[model samples]
Target: MHACARVGLDFLDSAPYRIVSTVDLAITPAQLFEVLADENSWPRWATVITKVTWTSPPPRGVGTTRTVTMRGGIAGNEEFLAWDPFERMAFRFNEVSTSSMAAFAEDYRVVPTSRGCHLTWTMALQPANLAGRIGLSLGAPVMNRLFQRFLHNLRRYTDERFSAQ
Candidate 1:
């Protein structure tokens, strides 16, 4: 078992905390991307995404950019790190107002499975300092749960919305 599992952790979230979970779903990449790209669809799928006001024109190709605001900060910018059309997209979170203990990178990859699409989302944090490491030890549970909840909702939305398409 991995160190996290040995400690009774099923998974780790990326934001300096590695909490992980595996979800099975039945959805297509195009259908998933349609929802993932629309800023309005965030609240419908992601639990922590309270707001997403587009900072630029909606992007259809790779390298598209958007200033996506999330719930953890006063203002959030979600820069598109990678966008493979209906395949995959990645972005990092930058707080415009609030200063977090750890910064994070989010990678959302959509893999086409025979049954459906497999989404792999990863969030990691930048070690702030020694104190930050200690904070991670304590905050991992909350952060892990938050990420899991987000993924869980995403899976549900994708399965329900996309599978019907």
Candidate 2:
């Protein structure tokens, strides 16, 4: 699936649409980078991310590849695209195969700013056939909601961690 975690499900309304979201948080790039580096720990921050079985080690860097599973039963392989620690983090995936499930690619990016950082996770999917078109179209708003939730959860996670230190 293009979307990792699932979000709001009020999709009986919209027909054809695309999901695009951008969120900024007030936290050190170092802190944000640490969170992004650990794929297994994703579920801890994203409420919808119930699972993340890592095929790599902590602080994943350039050329690293790992599988990402979400609470909504969505799973995909993520490959590191850019791994500039404390400054940027990005990844791409062409597919995520499973014993019984569909596979797709997802691109993730984290860019540092003067105050804190900006994290963007995006997916581009072209339906296999006209039959799948309805899904991609209806998925836009739902995915956008999931993206918003991710940002909300990320902010909470950062706040809790930084507060404890």
Candidate 3:
């Protein structure tokens, strides 16, 4: 894998391309965070993700690392920038299978609501070259919709998961 640019929390706000998706789930923040922390839970909701493996040992916190494999065999080595339990978690890719990404980061924030919890997911990226830039620009809209669908999937998965217990 090629090394990607290291990015900080600020990149979540300043990246050239960003997609923010939100969903209100009928689950508590703790339940949502539990799903986020479970490696097996990823592919259940994020259809594009194939696997997630923790590269760092427990207790997960800032600087923890993981490897995520997506559809099409795209893989990313990620380092957590923030890991406030039950509230916020964010990470950035340190290396990726492809060279088209100069930088990539994602932030997930959960807020308690009257009914359950509301999640805001932000994906930020900087293209490595002109080809990458054009591709992302054209695909941004579709990507946003897909991400939103992932959250909806999460809601359904969690409802079924928790309801069965």
Candidate 4:
């Protein structure tokens, strides 16, 4: 059986789509976790994330709200679902503007490696409709590449910033 099927994801509407990107960086898990936890600095390191503004109180934790604007004018109203410092952080977004998917959840995990740490990002998406499913199928490759760029950007930003410190 397919892994997606084993996960109990639906066929068309909730057709489970996951994008996972991993990068090994020469930084401690705590250092990488601090960067990942700071949503305000995302735009600086992530090309697709153009802007992020907190919609809830300070100190990002579970239930925190944030408005994120990505490249090409795509925006999403997101809320923090889980926040585990130096380990993982997860979020769900809805009420997207100028996007195909209706809602999606993303999680980032930082694991300690012998050299430094390995950061992995996982995102599962749900299509809004039939048309959205078609769009997801067709756009999956491009989205994967976009996320690859995001991982590259994270690595570059961390290298440049931490190496200078």
lDDT of each prediction vs. the true structure?
A: 0.62, 0.60, 0.96, 0.75
How far off is residue 75 in model 3, in Å? 0.3
lDDT (Cα, tens digit) per residue for candidate 1, span 75-141: 5554565678666666655444544334545666777899877777766555446776888788888
Per-residue C-alpha lDDT of model 2 across residues 72-157, encoded as one tens digit per residue: 46666766656777765555443544332222334445677886778765544444455567765666677778778877888888
Give per-candidate clash totals: 13, 0, 0, 0
* Model 4 stretches with alpha carbons more than 4 Å out: 1-15
All candidates: CA RMSD (Å): 7.8, 7.2, 0.7, 5.9
User: Model 4 over residues 5-68: C-alpha lDDT tens digits?
Assistant: 1121122124367787888889998888778767766987787788888899867788888888
lDDT winner: 3
TM-scores, all models, native as reference: 0.75, 0.71, 0.98, 0.84
Model 2: clashing residue pairs?
A: none
- The ten-residue window of minimal lDDT in model 3 covers 156-165
- Using TM-score as the measure, the top candidate is 3
